[model samples]
Target: SDLPLLCQHFINNYNQENGTTVKGISNETLQLLTTYHWPGNVRELNIAIERACIDARKGIITVDNLLRFTQNVSRQNISSENYRGFDIKEARKEAEKAVIIRALKASNNNRRKAAELMEISRSALYNKIIELEID
Candidate 1:
């Protein structure tokens, strides 16, 4: 769709501006960007793609390059969930669990790396992994 083409254009333009060799975006990367709900709209997408291109360094942009932006979008979606009768403590726990899961996934299930990403101690992450019953 237009999203992919837009991303491609942005990548091309960014390369030209930076004097870097133009690199292509993988279909997977385009799919990831297209599927995301851009809370900040085109401007945000433009910035994210620009950052992704810089991070990619003339290599194909991959989903990894878009992780931070996608994570922000996902967090916004989670925050919009209806908690109904849930107390503040319960909501906090839910949010914590979600963040822990994301950290784990982002770190490829490496507990140490996940803890570092969360800025928590390794033991704390292990404790949460047990407390949250995260699979």
Candidate 2:
């Protein structure tokens, strides 16, 4: 279907910008994607492709990588296990990590903008990034 070609368009664009060599989406992943209703249309497809590109491993976008697109992507970022512990400090760390990651993704990995999105100083964001080991 044209969906695969559309997916490839976004994937190729992402690879060019990121200097990544992601070959393409796997057949299974393409099948999965084609089955979705894509209620948000092309914009949603674009986001899904971007997210899959970021999460793709070993130069291929797999079914596992596309799974997040089918669900509430933001809600899946911080797994429930992160908050299962009783320690507030640990919970706080998990929350901060999740927020920082989200901000980074939202800002397209622009640290300065991510800091602004998080309402913190750039230095503070760097410090938190270091403390939390966010790569």
Candidate 3:
């Protein structure tokens, strides 16, 4: 409801500020954005939209534009078999894996620091790494 309007406002503001002529986002792309959980909230949404606008280059922001918004998460084509029939458990696993990988990378591969960043015990983090089969 209001999400689309919010996104539109963001896009309009960005276009005005940057002197770009991005018309609007496609319906499909808008649906995707509105439906996303947006774990990082409004700030993350703002950054994602801004980045997408830059990548769009005066064109209507497409799904491709949003797909590149986050490196940690996989927001690729939903029509792909990989995303088809997705369940909560699988989605949770994917999210956990992404977070763990991000934490590890941020901590320079130091498991203890990564665990601290995640607010989990070192052994718990180690167990998750093994369970998720993260190299």
Candidate 4:
């Protein structure tokens, strides 16, 4: 967010004062970064800024730093982005069934009370169990 950019600027200023001459960020990089949706958030920005600072020499921070960050984290989190080509519908149904079963167990098989706790209608809960064929 705004905090990471401010921190990066501050780091740049520190480098400037110490005569190290950190490269200024580019407009194109800023444009894409601002437009893109960053779900993982400011931590990703911090890594990017660090990489940029490390690679800077002639006063221009290229997009290469950002590319390096993506390449590094992509390998670590490929599973989160893809379900390994499994059927999404089946996975979702399985998850819904698991939730209902857990709710029933947590409420000691009291269907009405489980419905209230789950914020779902009792009729809907009954329909789901019947559809899933859970005893």
* Runs in model 4 lying further than 4 Å from the true structure: 1-10, 13-19, 72-135
Q: Write the per-residue lDDT of candidate 2 for residues 20-96, one digit (tens) a residue.
A: 88889887667556646677898888888888788789978875465433343322322222356655456556756
TM-score attained by model 1: 0.53
Q: State residue 15's C-alpha deviation in candidate 3, in Å.
A: 1.0
Best model per lDDT: 2
Give the lDDT of residue 71 in candidate 1: 45
Cα-based TM-score, every candidate? 0.53, 0.51, 0.54, 0.39
Worst 10 residues of 2 by lDDT: 73-82
Model 3 CA deviation exceeding 4 Å by range = 72-135
Candidate 1, 5-68: lDDT as tens digits: 8888888889889997657777766754564678788888788788777767458776555553
| Candidate 3 residue 119 C-alpha distance from true site, Å | 24
Task: Spell out the clash pairs found in candidate 3.
Answer: none
lDDT of model 4 at position 113 = 84
TM-score between model 4 and native = 0.39
Query: How many backbone overlaps does candidate 4 show?
Result: 0
Per-model tally of clashing residue pairs: 0, 0, 0, 0
Question: Candidate 3 lDDT, tens digit per residue, 1-135?
Answer: 777877788899998999998888878677666656778888887887888898784588876566545432233323111233456456546656766787899899999998886667999889989998999
The whole-model lDDT of each prediction reads: 0.68, 0.72, 0.71, 0.58
Per residue, candidate 4 scores C-alpha lDDT tens digits across 1-135 of: 575466457557647656777656665456435644556676665565666666665766544433333433322222121123455455445545656676788799999987785667999889988987989
Candidate 1 Cα misplacement greater than 4 A, ranges: 68-71, 74-135
